[model samples]
Target: MGNTVIEKIIQAHTADEVAPGRIVWMDLDIRSARDFGGPNVVKNYEREYAGLPLADKSKTYFTFDLCAPACTLKYADNQQACRDFARRNGVEVYDVDSGVGTHVLMEGGLARANGTVVGTDSHMNILGAIGAFGQGMGDVDVTFAFRTGRTWFEVPESVRVVLKGTFKKPTSAKDLTLYLLKVLGTKKIALRSAEFTGPAVAGLSLAGRLTLCSMVTEMAGIIGFIPECGAEARKEIESYTKTPYSPFSPDGDAGYAETIEVDVQGLSPQVAAPPSPTNVKPAVELRGTKIDSGFIGSCTNGRFEDFAEAARLLIGRKVKKGIMLKIVPATRRVYKELLARGILQDLFEAGAIVVNPGCGGCAEGHVGLTGKGEVQISTGNRNFAGKQGKGQTYLASPAVVAASCILGHIAGPEDL
Candidate 1:
């Protein structure tokens, strides 16, 4: 049998092979619920399929910090329901109020040996970063997970994203993925996996790679994967995957539905315009387009590296007049780290508002939102309609976000 992560998991369950979109009963190793996805799962379990009974309640996991402090009342109620549901059903709830993003919590401390995780959020695909075949589902599928401990799935075709060149500075994994999304089109890779490979991909940090894999859903991917257990992956493995995990890669003869090659050398900061992640253009193309807001936080780019880069650029500079920029670190730990390092003060001194650590302003339902007709540039993952409010949103790299916040317009790091 092949030792690839996906293959291993599939074979472990030994379910019938079926085409994509077909339902088959297979064991699901892990199932995740969060503020956004949990309520629906609970409601569906309580209403639609009343008393179907889960295979193993302990196998189900819940995280309360899905887009925290900035959440709406509906989300708040959903979170409470999730907690109540977990307690009532004997499922373990990880990080009750710690504010860790769902995927981060899973990779950091929730998912266990040779597991499969399904969550309501699309980015749950990020678990694949650690050699798991994670998938995102809607409330309906989640209800199924709660009922049977497993659900059905169509085997998705794979798209090989072979990186051939070293990524240039300011071209982090987030940028590379956005660049790929532009190349692939938003719906082009719908219901498929982008199996990342090549020397270039192997060289990136695990955190960087995770960010790339997490956003696959924005392009409508079923999931994303990179060969696991490299020196680069050791950092994550040390903290998450124990038990001598052997990484997996596709065989030379492995079948793939498509292959897309990209040369990332000299790839500068890129941006995704309003309404779609695939609507991309270079940051340089955005020069002089005035912005009313600049934000630097989200599951996609709210890491320590991202904040450090933003601080480096905004250390002594003040945000441009009429601009309201905010930083919402993805988790409480990141918030404390920045506070301890005094980066939070620097950001405040630079005229940026540092909101509570959560999914707030990034999703348009929180402390900072662009007013009507306002224009904002952000380091968030998506810019779908109504995201960040009824305004124009441009999704850019952290460097671009910092620089644009400083200049009050779309500008590159050098331009700042």
Candidate 2:
């Protein structure tokens, strides 16, 4: 059988023919951990390696993005330990105000296309947008990558997702991803790799591709793959995929465990209701559902394009009375760029509470926490019960969240 993109990538790393279900040790190009997993990874590395030095400090990265600025003393201590370890080991660390770990890695050009990257955060799969093989693992696995230069994996079967049509305006990559989750149902793709193909894939920007891949974690996917586009239209993306690193594409006759087609031309904005990312519904169906707050940022949909789209709808408008709106950039560079463009000023004038770039509010007990009996619409990836506090959370695109903030209800940009 012909090899899928993932299988080809694995073969390139192993220098041997590989197939799904086979275990192989692959050299890692990047190994990363964020605050939540950093300290544990460091502790485990010390305990296991003892006097042995890390395989290569330049290949590892540490970031303080979760609970950044330290929501509690314990969090602060954990971050300090991570900083100390990074300094001692000479590993690069992105501290507070730097940005989400994935964003930092992508924006800094540290994550190379066709490379293998493993991280302590599940959403590390987002790096697949650049044609890299990225997967999430436990702290112990991260420590193993630190101690040695390689990690092992069982090649995963591929799911072929063919995108046929362009998304309608206000119906973004986020909406399309939610629709996929709703169709496939969470866990159906677990331990499998998703290969995005078809005509529409050629038109998706890197930011859009990043948003699409980010939520594959919700489906328990090992990685999301977007093959190199051969057209001149893809020149920008080619910069990261061409030359020294072997660019990967599935063989024409590649075997796939399943094949699904998505026609985005008719797709509408989608929302995942409380307690599950798969509990998705068309945004219009939930219109007029009152919301106490809304958030317009997360690693999934916090790129500059997301903010620009949201600002287009939110400018000259004010958040509804008694309803709170929170805006967070995914990275410090994105934040500064938005500030230079007055996007932050527009959001601030709209009565939005602009917070630092981090994963703070996505989890409960941090900034933007909701209260009992409240409801919120957010752009965050998950909406599980109590994820953001003692309230119901709905997941939507940035445009949908921004519109809901203005209307005080679940709404789409069309409502404005």
Backbone clashes counted, model 1: 2
Candidate 2 per-residue C-alpha lDDT over 267-362 given as tens digits, one digit per residue, 9 for 90 to 100: 899999988999999999999999999887778888878888888888889999999888888889889989999999988988989888886477
lDDT of each: 0.73, 0.83
lDDT, model 2, position 242: 53
Candidate 1 per-residue C-alpha lDDT over 1-416 given as tens digits, one digit per residue, 9 for 90 to 100: 22334554665674676434445566887777777767888988889766566778877877665556425677667777888878888887754345545545544655543567787767777767766777778888888887788786666766777777775676777778788888877666677767787765776666677678778878888777887346756665556554555646666666566778877766777889888888988877868898888888776777667888888899978888888888877777778889999999988898888877665565444454777898888877778878667988888877888889888889888886
TM value for model 2: 0.94
Instruction: Please provide TM-scores, in order, for all candidate models, with all chains considered together.
Output: 0.90, 0.94
The candidate maximizing lDDT is 2
After superposition, the stretches of candidate 1 with alpha carbons farther than 4 Å from their true spots are: 1-5, 18-23, 48-53, 70-72, 94-96, 112-114, 228-233, 242-245, 362-368
Q: RMSD to the native, candidate 2?
A: 2.2
- Which candidate gets the maximum TM-score versus the true structure? 2
